[model samples]
Structure formats: C-alpha cells, structure tokens
Target chain A: MTMRLVRTELVDSREILPGQWLQSFLAPELSSGSRAGQFVHARTGDLSGLVLRRPFSINTADPATGVITIHFRTIGRGTEWFTRLRPGDTVEMLGPLGRPFEVDPRSRHLLLIAGGLGMAGVRSLADEAINHGRQVTLLFGAASARDVYPSSLLPDEVEYVIATDDGSVGHKGFVTELVPDYEGWADQAFACGPAPMLAALARIAEGRRERLGVAKLGRKRGVGKPDVVGSTAARRKAFLQVSMEQNMGCAVGACLGCVIMGTNGVPQRVCREGPVFAAEEVAWESGW
Target chain B: MSPADLSVDLGRGLVLPNPILVASGTFGYGIEYGDVVEVDRLGGICCKGTTLQPRIGNITPRVTETPGGMLNSIGLQNPGVDAVVAKYAGTWAGWKTPVIVNVAGESVEDYVEVVQRLEGVSGVAGIELNISCPNVGRGGLQFAIDAGAAGEVTAAVRRATDLPLLVKLSPNVGDVRPIARAIADAGADALTAINTLSGIALAPSRRKPLLGNIYGGLSGPAIKPVALRIVYEVSQVVDIPVVAIGGVTELADVLDFLAVGAVAVQVGTAIFADPTLPVRLVDELTDECERRGIASYAELVGTALPPKPGAPSSKGVEYRP
Candidate 1:
C-alpha cells in the first residue's frame, strides 16, 4: 500500500562488472520504506517504443541518504536508456513494489545466495541483516570471473564467497554447492537467482532439519495453527525464501503478466504474491 | 484561459466529468494504484474484464514488450463478477468517478448473466461488453470476428441491464464497419474501438513463441494508426459515440483520436509507463480546448474526418464486416 510513483534523479552510474551496471537514484519517498527483495518499476524514455516500464529489485536503499540503487545488465533498450541518464536526469519510478524478503526476528545467522545478475536481488539483504546485528554469509555465482559482482560494493561484515563456472573464483561451482557447508550454521536462507538455482536450493532446504538432526524442543510453536500459505508469517518462518523473476508487464498485479506456478495448483502473480516467496510456495518443477 | 467543459455523456445517464478513462486490464480495479492515482479526478474507471466464473488466466510469460507496444495474453484473468461486486463495488460507489465493469464471457447467456448481476449494483456505472479479447482459446475472437454474434450478445446484454452499454470492437476482422453498425443498431450506447490486434513474438531461443498463450493482443503506440482507422470507419458508420483506445501516450494522441472521430479516449498500455497519464491528459485536453478557443472538447471531434456516408476515399478496402 506504500507503493507510489516517485520522481528519482540519477545520482551516479557505473559498470561494476563486464556488462553489469549499477546506478544510484535519490528517491526519499521510496528509499525510506523499501525492503530488500522488493522492486521498483522504472519508466524509460517515453519517445522510444518502450511501452512497458522495467522492473528492478531495490538493489540497495539508503534511507539516511534518501538514495536507492538498482543493479542490472544492459540487456535491452529500457536498460540501455537508463544507462544514458546523466547525474541530474530524473525518471518516474513506481515503487517500493512487491513483497520483500521476510526475515524472522528470531534469525541470527543469515545465508544469502545469488546467481549472475540475481545478485542484485539479494545484495541489499546483507546490509539489512548486518544492520540488525546478524552474521551474514553470501555465496555468489556467475559464468566467469569477469561477471562476478565486485566485492568492493559489498558490506565488509559479509562473508563474501564466490563461484565461477570456469573456476576463476573462490568456489568453482554453482553457488548452491557452497550452501550445504553453511546449512547447519544459518538460521535462515534467502536467495535470488535463475530458476534452476533456486530450485536446487529448495531441494536442499527441504532436508536441512533432518541433516542437522535438530529436534523439536517442546510444543513446536503454533503446532495446530498453520501459517496461512502466502502470508508474511509463513514466508518469514520458511527456511529458504527466494526472489523470483519473470517477464513482467504492469508490475502492479493488474496485468497478470509475471506469474509463476504455485504448489497449490494456482498461478500466482510474481508482482503481487511475490517477486519473493517461500521455497515451498512455488511449484519448482511445474515448468512455469 | 476560461475553463473548457470537459464533461462527456456516454448516453443513458452515464455522464463523465471528463473524456479520459483508464483502459480495462491496465488500471486493475482503480484501487491497485492506491495513492499514486487520484481515482476521482479522471473521467471514468473501467475495471478489469470480468467473467461469469473466476478465471485462472493463462500460463506464465503472459506479456512481453514489442517494438512500439506490448503483447499480452492474460486471457481475461479476473475474479467472478459476484466477487468483484462484493469486494470492490462499495469502494467504487463511494468514489465520485463512475466505475464501468467490463464483462467477458464464452456465451451470450454468460454475458447476459453477468450484466444481470450488475444491473443495480451501487458501484456498477456501465457495462463494457468485451467480445474482442484475443487471448482466450474460444469465445473472445469468435464474437468479435462476425457481425451477427456481436449484435446478438450486445442485444442480449442490452435487454438484461438498463445501465449504459459500450461494446469494444476488435481489429482482427478483415473489415469492421458492418460489425460497428450492427452493435450500434443493437442498442449499445457507445462503441470503444479498437481492442488489441492479434500478434505474436518469438522467444529468444528463436525456436518458439515468447508468450505462453502463443498469440497475444497487441497494444500501445504501434496499434494507434490501426485504432484510428477503425474509429474513423466506425464513427462514419454508427450513430453512437466512439470511445477511442490504443497507444494514447500524450495530449497529441488524444487530439488525434478525437479528430479521427473518437468522442473520448482510453489510455491503455501507456498507463504501464505513466500511471498518472490519463489524469494528466484530462488536464492537457482541457487546456487544449481553452487554447483552441472552443467551449467544449466535442467541437474538436471528427475534425480530420472526411465527409460522411458512402464517400469514396483513396485509402481503405471496400469490403465491410
């Protein structure tokens, strides 16, 4: 409901990797209320044929500075137009859209994962977790070293770990490979990446309790009252929550354009129910 | 500059404060925009396409951006009409603006039943019969492609509800004049021309179509000229007012639609880029009327249109729907 149309001025723009660009915008209205995993629907130059606004994860929001950053690769004309903006250039952005990653108050050690451009989806959570005095371990993956998100951009408190397909980084495999090592250590896991990567993590998060041999202490809280499927409480308690991606139209849920198959046999709007959802809420193999 | 009268009467008691409306499917229920849009400021709010039964919509990847437009195959996803009335009708009734519920169905009876349910609903200001939806497997393109079916459904809905009726035309047919005339004669108060044109985009793999529904209704600036042509042709043939829609991005586009014989205009795909556009367009149109030394926006309507009835033009096919 706090979603709004805010005029954002480009503060700075830079290419952090080979093709990935990170641009910062000063939007007090959006930055103050935004949560990690939530996104903004940005309008491009209207003169061109780009009819749909581009949706970007609120890569990072600095309420103190009234600045928000969006990280993306110049994949199409929309992004190409964004990169052309100068420092004083202003654009309209509809934001703080979609639901953000629901981190539990009880969680202390958080595990973050990102694949390629998916890093933009979860990068902000690290800053948030550290601000809450939570320990964070970030596992990142990309096709090559040149594509890795720069470590200089991350908070120093984060235990940054990287994986490259060509083995030019810390771990030479998919970031999911690094998850098991920290599985028992992390109280909760949050990820943003390709569908396959999230699916793999979902498979891993399923048996975590058994793998760690953690027993229910006593009347496992709220034993009879179930967490309503897509509620914030349900997502907050989920072991692994992922920020999803799909081709989006009206990021405001009206268009029903960006949807993913839900395990409950209904298609859920990625813009409404989520750009983020609990791992189990999604029908991982439904081929959505 | 003196204030130009921006009000529009769509006939049978559906009078709007202005000539700008947010197109169906784009504006949701008019509540989705929250504080971003001032709902009461616009001419009207056309709610999403509603069916007799709740629709789950199509598979994923329902939309994609095209050259100057976007392709959407949302398949008319909406809660059943009853749920729509139960949930959003009260809120709509409270707002000063009229909320027209857009009805779509597989059968004429289905359209009639939906209209009957909304006949006296407090928030339901008008019924826009959507026979032109191209995304659904059946029913949609069927009623729109032929003149008889379009008339049959419009007449049935007309008998069902006393509320104002507007039939949205499809651009998929070879010719649309006959169909427009048929709907007008069948008692629709006005015509909203044209609905999205059917089109397809290939996936990046180049092996398959990009949209899950395969073919999507093409909307946005790319289809403006086609919309203008239909509005031009249909306005010439029908006595009812033509509510123009399709890629209206600015005040200029609004004027263009008006000159082509559209009494009012709906901003559809452009809303995705600028949520405040329709309201802003209302202001711009008012200013335009003031600047043109006109007392009403109606004076600008049909300015670019050629002389009426059976007049031969260098352009256009002779065939009629």
Candidate 2:
C-alpha cells in the first residue's frame, strides 16, 4: 500500500489514567486502510531536541467517523509533547505502516494478551475480530487496579479478563498465569508486552499442543518443508504470535535501528519484517 | 532576484542542483519514505552505507535520544554493493536528484572493491567514504583517526574509480587539519565534516549500556558546534569543498555551516523527526539568499571565516574553539 504523510488534526485528547493519555485524530486516509496491528509514526511539534517521530500502535480506527486513536503513557519528552497537543492542532503522520497481525480465517476463537500500555497494540484486534463475528477473550495485565484499562472503553462484546501484580485487581499474578485457563478454548493467541512476559507465554505455547493432545492437521502436506521464519504463512499457522518493540529511528526500516534477533541467525527489522512474529521465529534467549 | 541560485559544485563532475542533501544512514535508499517526501526536489540523497558483503549490523537498542541529540550504533547494515546496484540504481537513474552511495568497509581493500563495483553504475553520481563509522568493530574510525591511513584509503579508492570522492571526517580527533589536508592531497574531490562524536548512554535500569554496541555516534544539534569548528578548521587547510553534516534541522544551521566555509550542508538525524525537512531547507535557503540579495549561495560561504594573513583575525580561532 502507498504510505502518505497526512496532516492530521487532533479532534480529541483526554487523560485516560494518571499518566496515560488517549488522543484521537481526524485521519481518514489512515483510518480507512489501516488494520488492527499496524502503527503510525507521529512527528512531534518541538523539533529543537526531539529528532525522531514516536511510533504508536493504531489503538482504534473508525472509518465511518474518519478518526484514529493512539493510547500512550507520558514517559518521555515525545509522549509528553503528544499530551500537550490541543484539538485543531495538526500533526504529520506516516502510516498504516509495518506488518499487521495475521489472523487465521478459520480460527473461530481468538485469545489476545496485553501488558500495560501494550494494550494499545492488541486492542484494535479485539474490535476487528468481533467485527468478523469471532469470539475474543482479552487477558489484560497491569501494575494495579489504578493502572488497569477502564472497561468502559472496550466493546461490550469482548470477554475482558484482568491480572494485576498487586492483589488489588482480578488475578493476583502475571497475565501469563491466566493463559492456561483459555489455551484449550482458544484456536489462536496473540500477545504484546514486556519481553519476559512474551517469552514466558512462548514457552507455554510450545507445550500446549502436547498438553491438549490436539491433532496436527495439514502436517503431511507440509512435511520436509521448513517454515520460513518471519513469513506470513509461518505466523498464521503458529499457535502464538507476538508484537515486539525496540528503540526505533526511521520506523520505515531505513535506519536499521529497530532490529531483533531472529531464529535463523539473521536480524529482523521490526518495522519491516514485523512488530508481529510467530513465537517460534524469534530467538528469545539470544540476549539481543 | 529569481529565487537566489542555490546550486553548488564539488569538483570532478559532481554538481548538486541545491546544497541540501539527506545524510547517509538516515535517508535509507530514498525509497523508504514513499510519497511522504518529494524525492526529486531534494538536492541529493546519500543512501545507506554499502559494503562488499551484506552486513546484519548491530543488535537491539541501536538508537537512543539524548538531551538535544541522539546516539546511534547502526554498524552500517546494508544489502551489499551488488544488491544495491541491482536494486536501486535503475530507480535512482530516473530521478533528477543525484544519489551518492555512501561506502563503508572493514579495510582499505574492502573500500576499493566496493567502489570498483559502483564505478559505472547508472544511478551513482558520486561516492561518500564513511571512514568514520564509530559503530563498527574495526576499519571505520581507524581510517579517519590517522592522516596516513585516511589519505591511503582515499587514494586507493580514487585509483579504483573516477567517481567524485568525498571523505567523511571524524570528530573524535584532537586535531583535524592534517587529516583533512592529507585526504585533499590524495585527490578527494570534497570533504564531509564531521561524523558523529563517540558517546554512550545507560539503559533505563542502569544495569548496563543502552546501545547494543556499547558505543554510538552522537548526532543532532548537540554536535552542531563541533561540526562548525571542524568545517572551519578543515576548510582552512584543504582547497577542496566541505559538505557539513551534524544536527542540521533548520536554515540557520545550514547558513552557519556555509559561513564557516562549507559549500553544502547535509541533514542527518533531523530526517527522523521530519522527512520533508531536507526539501523544505532547500526552499528556505533560496529564500534566505534572495532576502540577502545575494546572486548565489556561494557569496554566503566563508563569510564568517577569519580574515587572511595580511588582515586582522576578527574574533580569532582561539575564541571560537
């Protein structure tokens, strides 16, 4: 798809949590064509010190209203600058970029997992899955009840589950602890979070097939043919797919600034090859 | 007064329609930005660094933002010389803007071999030697640190191809004049001063270094002063033109570089914040020249340099340094 640099006007901005923000922009070009897991590289207003545009997952996109939203926490100058933007202020955005999450067509049950601000990464997928008449279970984890995503913002159709580190919330443990309850019920799983958490879930996903004793379908047709790591076909067939994060420069795969170690001993560009990848395709313990 | 001529020529058949170029490593191969930028309007595009073999580059956390700049340790990741010539040469040949390939190598022979492969490539207008890539393990900063090595590499590549050669200088040196002179005497058409200063940052946890390579080249406004000083020092010793690079985000930065004897300026880290900046600077520079009623931008060059020997040194070099 042709990526355009559009001048998007901020239509709404609000403080969703203590330090978290949710901003909406009137970007018809981005909202119309962007999928669930794609993101936009937004240019900040102050050019003096901040030299790189911030990459934000498209948290939500409404083509009917021509509005796209981004959810973020004010952790640094770039995020702080975004919070200061008022409605009517125009910001330049380069997007509908990076590969989007590929959901298997026949998968009727989809399990989504998100940690903290990573909710922004998988939030849109919930909406997209429901629109396709698939059942979605979103397992969200946060630091405490105060930092948990407000259920009022999600669609009424989703089965929202929460796990907080502190016992003040739903499940008093890591979100990966809540996966086993839904592994058997889910046909496919997608996640985005801290590396350790994703790695933990990946380990669990490895043993899931044997634990559930699920028959490997279509194995004979693909015998002797190794799946190409990071390929769309590989990600589609894997039980777990994850969205990865890195310190980025161009966000269009030019600078080679955001790369992660791949299983094949080659470095993968997060902005080009993925922000999405099959759990098996990444070399988790490579310490890259 | 027709939009003040901004074109510049860095000898040996290389002429930029304007003086603003997108720096190497930052602009990719000129196709990554898609329609976001008007590629044809740019003065030039220095595509990502190329080598004899495809390099995977460094590990994760290759970039980080500092107070007024950023540090990057990309290690010159590229698809190799042959792949580059095959993939982008045809596309670049169709554009009005010149595409200068930035070549990096692990050794002097590596640099010459890469240049030889690019000698007759259709889209290549010139060659920019990345002799000061601070991210690599070897051969990058080695060539730029010593005068003999810098000149030797420049001369080797000069013999390999007839392409206009621009050798990039490193800011890590204590004195840059000798290296600058050696490279110019070696037949380099121009010089690009300065490459990023070596620096490092701590991870958020403070457990270890932030960048995977442990060290990164710092660029942006933080290095502008250092760049201006090097350009001033190098331009005085070398007869060839100087193309200044380091944290150029606006017209004032461009003018500052030119005043210090830089014939052209390159926008590097700033492109990440605004991909359209290089093209915008070209327009703004023309306006600045017109506002000053200058016939061409060349009149603005070396305007702030110390007067010649017979004349008094207004504000002397020591004061600026």
Candidate 3:
C-alpha cells in the first residue's frame, strides 16, 4: 500500500529497559495496513525546538487490538519527546513506508538476528513468521542482561537466544557466533544491527552458500538464468537480507538524505528503495 | 467573476492564470508534494536549484531548526540542469501550471551556459536565478554581494534566452536598491528578494557548530522582517515586478509581502511544517480579495509602499513641521 500521514493516540508507554522505551499507539489504520520491515515517521512534540519527525521501525502490530508498538532508546530530544507523550495524546505519523522483508514461501524455518535497539527493525518478522506456520529462531545481542529484550513480549512459538557483551546473559560473545549452529537448520536468515554486526552476518551468509554448495531456492528452475539482483524474488532466494538505518529527510524520496552506498556505485535512498536490502546490494565498507 | 480577468501579464506576454507561485527549492521539482498538494492549482512552480552538474552537496546534518525558524546548508544538491530537464520535463509538460526552472551556477559562463541549455525546453516556462545560496563559500557570495557581477550574469543569461528571467536577491548585501536597479537595468523580467540570511548555530556541546557545514542559511518566520525590509527597499527602486521569498509561513506573510510591494510571495521553510500551506494561501488570497471587493489580488500589491511622493496618500499632505 502507498504511504500516508495518520493520526494515532498513545495507548501505552513503558520502560522496557533502563533507558529504552516501548510505546504503543492505537492506530488501526497503521496496524492493519503495515507489514513487517515497514516503518512510521512519527511526529514528536514540538518542544525543545525539534523540527524533524523521528522515523521508527514498527516493533509489533496487532490488528485485532488495533495497536502498533515502537521500541527506541532515549538518545536525544526527538525520542525523549515521544516518551513524554501521555496516554490518549494524538500524534501524527506518515507511515507503512519502505519495502518489507520478502520471505520466500518455500522457506519454512526463518532465523532472525538483532543487536540492541535493532530489535525493533526485526521484531515484527517473528510474529509474521509464526503466523505463517514457520519456525522462528531469534538470536539477540545486548550489552548485558538488563539490556536484553524481555522474552515474555515475544510469541511463545519463537525460540529466543541472547548474547551479552559482558557475559551477563546467555551467550557471552557476539551474536554472530550463534548463527553457525543454526546455519544448517535455518532455511533463510535476516539480520538488523550495528554496521559491523550486519557486515559480519553478510560475510557469513556469503560463505555459507559457497561452502555448502547450497542450491539456493528457485535455482533448480535454472542455473544460468538472469534474475534481477535487487528484486524481492532475488532477495528471497538469497541466504540473508539486512535492514539499514540512516538520518533521513522528507521520508518520501524527495530529499536524498537517507542514502546508503549501493554495489552499483550510486547511493540508494533508504526511504524509497529500502530500509531493507539484500546483503550483496550494499557496499559494506563504503562508510556512508 | 470571469477567470480571464484574473490573468496577469508577467512581462514578455508570459501571463499567469493567477499570482500564487510556489517558490523554488521548497517545492522540489513540483512532484514531491504527490497527491497531497494539487500542482495544477498554483499559478506556477519554481523548481529546486539546478546547476550545470550534479552536486553531492554539503556534509551530513544539512538542516536544523532555530528559534521560530530553521537553517539549511543544502549546498544546492541537484542532478544538473540536463538531468532535471530529461527526468522532469515530460511530467511538467503534462501539467497546466508553468514550471519555472531555478538556476544557480559558479561563474558568469556557468550561468549563461545553464540558461542556454534551458532555452526552448517544452516544460520549462521561465528562469528563477538562485544567486544567493549562502552555504557555499565561493561562487554563491560573488554574484550576490556585487552589483556589477549580478548585472553581468543577469545580462549574460538574458542574452542567452528569451525565457522570463526572475533574479532572486540576497538579504546579506548592504542596501539592495542599487543591486535591484542594476538587475532591472539588465532587462530581468522580475526580481525576487530576498534569499536566506546567513547564520550559524553552535552545537549543543558548545565545542563545535551544530550544522555539519559549520554555517547555514537562516529561513522561516524569523527572517520575515529582513525580507520585508529588502523587498520594501528594492520595490521603490526597480520598475520590474518583485516577487518576495524568505520566512513566508502564513496568509499574513503573503499580505505583508504584497503590502510591501511584492507582486507575489513564495512559501519556503514553512512547507516542512505544513506542506499544504501554499495551496491554502492561494485559496485564502482569493477569498481575501473577494472580501475586500477587489477584482484581482494584484490590487493589494504595493498598498503600503509609502506612497511615491505625489500619489493619492501624499497629495493632500503638507509639511506641517
């Protein structure tokens, strides 16, 4: 569906962690229309001289409850403004934007990975995968147990694993280390995290296809057939897809603010082409 | 009540159906508003600044908010004039409203070259010279501050094209009258004053500047007074019509610009806060004219221009002192 501005009321706000917040808005229009990997450009309170609306990934959307939640850290004035909004306060949002993660129908097992606040980027996919009768294994990394997302918020069907940087939780190392154990089990992997972690995951995903001589989905149809590299079909056939983040303007592709260097040498707009892209489409080390 | 009576001849027989034109940069290439704003309703659309070549623009943090306003150091990030004409001309040609191409360049040759390329473009209706983008250090200030340079470029572009040329004036210059007069003398169809005022904001940490470019151009409601001052001064000196820009956020601002001798106004920074403003202003202006029993909105223009010495407002007055 095309994107549009919507007004939603604050249903609830809670401190999911010490400095992290999970706020739910009562937006039936957004909850029903939005899909996994889409985001909302939320209007913040016009206090503290903030002008730009903050972009947040939809953490969870419950069409039955007509509610959508966003998870964020109180990094600056814009996010702080959202936390201060009282229940029943109406906030405007331009929404259901950017392309969603294209899951192949043939894939039955989906492996998800997230780092800290990146959970919001991949959270909805777990719900979507479970509803589609797919097995989901979520590998999450945080600074410590206190920073780990509560398992209670997730669907009971998901097998959740955690990695804390300080050894205060389940796995005591980087979350990428856990992917090898599930590489043979997972049909496809999707990740969202800091640039370094996503880069690491991309490297692993690239090697997995080669090391296993993995006959990628749809490959049986033809070996040398030319498929469009960046299309949803190509992304679904790949072993890994990643969600990216950048500072944005217009959020509607007018201003080219949120751009990431693509493998094609031209900068792709994160708001238009994607906040999500296949691992190979991005120039992982362009530093942009 | 006839719509034909509202048509205005903006020199060289380039008549506008009405007088409400969306300013350059703020409206992008006129397609940015999408379905939210009806582009055909506006009198015209002045597109974003187009250079001879594509510009990557300034570093990150290009825009920020200031007190009752905002600052932008966009650095004229465009995909060159040719790319723009190639990409948007077909779409623009399909529209009823005229699309005025806002041109900016680094030198006299650059200005002439860009305008020459725009000549005879089917979609393009006119040229709006953005000679006052303050974010760039070099070419931006050179043409705006010096009258001779401004006129030199204007005359060069005039020689290059028969298109309606509207030269935008910078508020940074001291006394815009001579500059306005020089531009008018060079045969510009109209004048647009003023572009943004140069300003800087320190970072919150106070260790560095807030904007990535270290400095930015001040716009929005805060610069309305400065814009009014420059427009008021330039209107008295120039014979050609003056279109005003800078800090026009509401209907009052449009009226204020008209009262201060601006034939039309361009809404800029305010489009960020309210994208529907320009369209709303067009409706409000017509309603305002109807309420005042004026046949056209042009009748409201220059109503506060300190009555030229022997005009009606000064005819009966005497030196009582």
Candidate 4:
C-alpha cells in the first residue's frame, strides 16, 4: 500500500541467458518498501504504437544501494522497448504493487518453485527467507540448460535444484516432480510458474495433509479456528502460496482486467487483491 | 495576459473547476492510484460503470494491447450502486473537484433507480448516463444506437433525478447525430461523444479470442480520429455542451478535441501507461492558453468546424440514402 510514482534510472542492463535479461534500476523510494512477490508497472520509453505499460515483478531489491532489478524475455514490442535502454536512462514506474508473499513467522523451512520466466516472481524471496534465518530450497524448471536461471545469481545460502526437459541439468523432468522430495521436510511452499504447473502444484498441496496423516485438531476454545480464505492471515498460514500473472491494464483494481477466479466464485484482482494468493484460494480448474 | 480560465460549466449548476476529467473504468473510484494522481486537481472524475446489482464482471484475459491502443471487456464489474455510494461518496465530498457517477444498467428502470439513489447524496455531484456500454450481454448499447431508445432512457432518468445528467454516445453506430440530438432534446445537460468501438484480438494459439467475453471496446490513440469525427458532427447538431472522450494522451490531443467543439475531454486508456498524464495535461493546457494569449480556453472550441452549413461529417454522408 506504500505506492509511489517514482522515476527510476536504469543503472545496469545485461542478458543472462539467450533471450532473457536482468535489468537493474536505481529507485530509492521503491526498493525499501517493496516486498518479495510485489511488482512495478514500468512504462515504455517509446509509446509510439505501444499504449499500455508493462508489469514486471521485482526480481531483487537492494535497499542499501537503492537498487531493484526486473527479469523479462522479449515477448512483445513493449518488452523490446525496455531492452533498448542504456545506462542512466529514466523509466517511470508505479509500485510496489499487489500483495507480497506472506511468510509465517514460526516457519523455519521454506520451499520455492519456479518455471522458466516465472523465476523473476520468486527470486527475491530467497533473500528474504535467508535474511530471516530460514533454510531455503529452490526448485526450477526450464526447457533446456540454455534457459535455466544461473545459480550464481541466487543467494549462496539457497539450496538450488534444477530440472530441464532435455536432461541437461540435475533432474530430467518437470520441476513439479521435485516437490514431493521436499514437501514433507519444508514447513510451507511458495511458487510462481505456468498455469498448468501451478495448478499441478495446487493439486499436490491439497493432498499433502492427508498424505502426511497430520492429525485433525479438535476445538480448543469451543470451536477450531480457521483463517478466512484470501485474507492476509489465511495466506500467512496456508500450505502453498503462488504469485499469479495476467494480461494487465491499469495495474490497479480499477480496470478489473488482470483477474483470476477464486474458490469463492469471485474474481480477484492480481494487482490489488494479489499477485500472491494461497493455492486453496484459487479455483484452479475454473479456467479463468 | 491574465491567468487562463480552465473551468467548465456543463449546465444545471454542475460547473467543473477544469476540463480534464478522467474517463470511467480507468480511474476506478479515484483511490486506486493512491497518492500518485491529484484527484482534487481534476475537473471531474467519472467512476467505474455502476449497475443496480453487484457484478463480478467478465472472465480471464479481460484486456489486451493492440497497435496504439488496447481492448478491454470488463463486462461492467462493480460492487453495485448502493455499495459504490456507501464507499466513496464521503471521500468525494471533501475533494475540490466534481465526481460524476457513470451509471450503466440493462433497463430504463435500472438506470433510473441507480440515478435516483445518487440524487441527493452529498458527495455525488452529477451523473453520466452510460447508455453505450458494450461489454455486457444487455449492456444498454441498444439505447446508444437508436434515437427513440436513447431519448426514452434519458427522459426516464431525467425525471428520476435533478442531478446534472450527461449521456455518453457510442462510436459503434452508423450515424450518431440523431441519437445525440434525441438525448440532448430529452434533457441531457451535456453529451460525451464516442465510447469505445467494438473490437477483438486473436489469442496467441490462434484457436480462440484473446478476451474472455470474445469482444471488447477499443480505446487509446487508435480511436482518436473516429472520436474527433463524432464530436465534430454531433456538436454541430446539439445545443448542449459536448464532452469528447476516446483516446486523449497528451496536451496536443486535448487541444485537437477542443478544436472539434468538445467543451471538455476525458482521458481514458492513456491512464494505464501514465497515471499522472491527466493532471499534467491540466497544467499544460493552461500553459497552452497562456502561450496563445487567450483569456479563456473556451475560445478554442469548434475551430475545426465549418464556417457554413451543409458540411457533412464525412464526404459520403450526403451520398447515403
């Protein structure tokens, strides 16, 4: 909710993979307040034919240096416009928008899952978890080793695991296959990926409790309490949290453009209500 | 030269401090931008499309970007009229600008009920009848295309509330003048020319439409010329103030709209790219008037209009049977 229209200067821009980029900005007003899963709506310098501003997740933020970075691939003309910028160029951005990944204070172990470009959405959380003295495990999936996110870019404290479709990396298969290995050990899971991938993870998270045979708690104070779905407290206690993306318009609740149907039969704004939500909160099969 | 005047009077005692109003659907309830935009500095604020009942709106992929514009089929998703007035009216009453509620409904009674509820509200300043919303299945577009339906709805709402009423025109119609005239004659204080034109974009898979509802209203710079043509034609035929809205991005676009006889221009799709553009345009417009040494911006209206009668909206208008 601490949002501002700040003018950020592109201090660094580099291509880490074949077509993927890692660009950093000097935004003092935003880097500190932005959380792990929040995003910034970056406007294109050349809006000659491109009208809408592109939304990018805050990949990493360094409050000490007043720097924040965004990761993206050349998907369309709007993104291509960002690749053409040089050092010291200015970009007008509105941030840090949407809800961030809510971590329970008592949790000591955290698991993060990402697919392809979805890495940008969860990369910052590793820093947050490590800074809080929590053990972190990151499982990533990519088409091939060429597209795999470089491990050096991550915090050294993170336990990096990778799966490539072509078997050019540690595991040969989808990243979801790696979740079961750590599901029991990790207290909670966070993810950002393709819809099918996230949906598959939601299915897995839904069955984890019964699979582990965790005892159903009896009423403590007359009734067993449960967190309300889609609420911040509910997300803070959920088994799995995800950062969702959609084709956005205003990057605010106004346009009602970037929405995903919730389990409660109401459409939630990815900009205002969340970029992050509990897996149970989303109606995965609803196909919104 | 003295300070240039930017105020706008839409008649029936609804006078705006300026002419740069934010279009509905883009600004939300004027709080989405947080502190980025100075809503009090705007001439007026047209909030999101409101209906009689709470609506959840359309499904996924509700918006997409095209060349020089964007397409959206939000399907009038709102928390209903009663919820809207209960939530934001108090905050609006404290602001310096006017907040015009944009009402959308499936029937004439629905429109009247929504307006009547807002009639005596303290924060509610006026009403903009959205008779041209094209997102919903029965989204009131029928009134926008036909003169009789347009007049009927306006007359009903006119009787229900004494608040300043402005009926928005849709550019999807073949000829907009008759409908514009009917609504004006039926007691609309102002006319907002050119709602979004209907359009669709293909999905990347090429197997389906990009938007969930399959069709959306096109807005942005792509629709500016079409809006100008409508403003020029309708202004000549209607006596009420013409408020043009389609794709206003910069001060030049604002001036261009004024030249075609729009007393005010609403900034719509451009807000997605730059939230501060509307407020900046308000300042730039005053600077523009000072540069021209004009005492008031009103002298700039209708400059592109013809000096004589018989000037058709387009070259083929007279040829149409």
Over 4 Å off, model 3: A45-48, A215-234, B1-9, B133-141, B199-213, B311-321
Q: What's the interface RMS deviation of candidate 1?
A: 1.0
What tens-digit string does per-residue lDDT give for candidate 2 at A1-288?
Answer: 567788899999999999999999999999998988889999988887788889999999999999999999999989999998999999999998888888888889999999999999999999999999999999999999999999999999999999999969899999999999999999999999999999999999999989999744335355657678778888888889899999899898788899998999888989888899989889999998
Instruction: Give the alpha carbon lDDT tens digit for every residue of B175-216 in model 1.
Output: 999999899999999999989999999998999999988999
Full ranking by TM-score: 4, 1, 2, 3
Fnat, 2 decimals, each candidate: 0.93, 0.84, 0.11, 0.94
Q: Can you write out model 4's per-residue Cα lDDT over B9-104, one digit (the tens) per residue?
A: 999999999999999999999988888888889999999999999998888789999999999999898999999999999999999889999999
TM-score of 2: 0.94
The TM-score obtained by model 3 is 0.88
Off by over 4 Å in 4: A215-229, B133-141, B308-321
- Over B37-150, each residue of candidate 3 has an lDDT whose tens digit, in order, gives 788888788898999988766664666767766677767778898999999999999998888899998877788899999999999889999876432335356687878878
Per-residue lDDT value at A15 in model 4: 95
* DockQ top scorer: 4
Per-candidate TM-score, chain A: 0.96, 0.97, 0.97, 0.96
Minimal lDDT window, size 10, model 3 chain A = A43-52
RMSD of each: 4.7, 4.4, 3.7, 4.6
Model 3 sits at an interface RMSD, in angstroms, of: 3.0
How much is the lDDT of residue A131 in candidate 4? 94
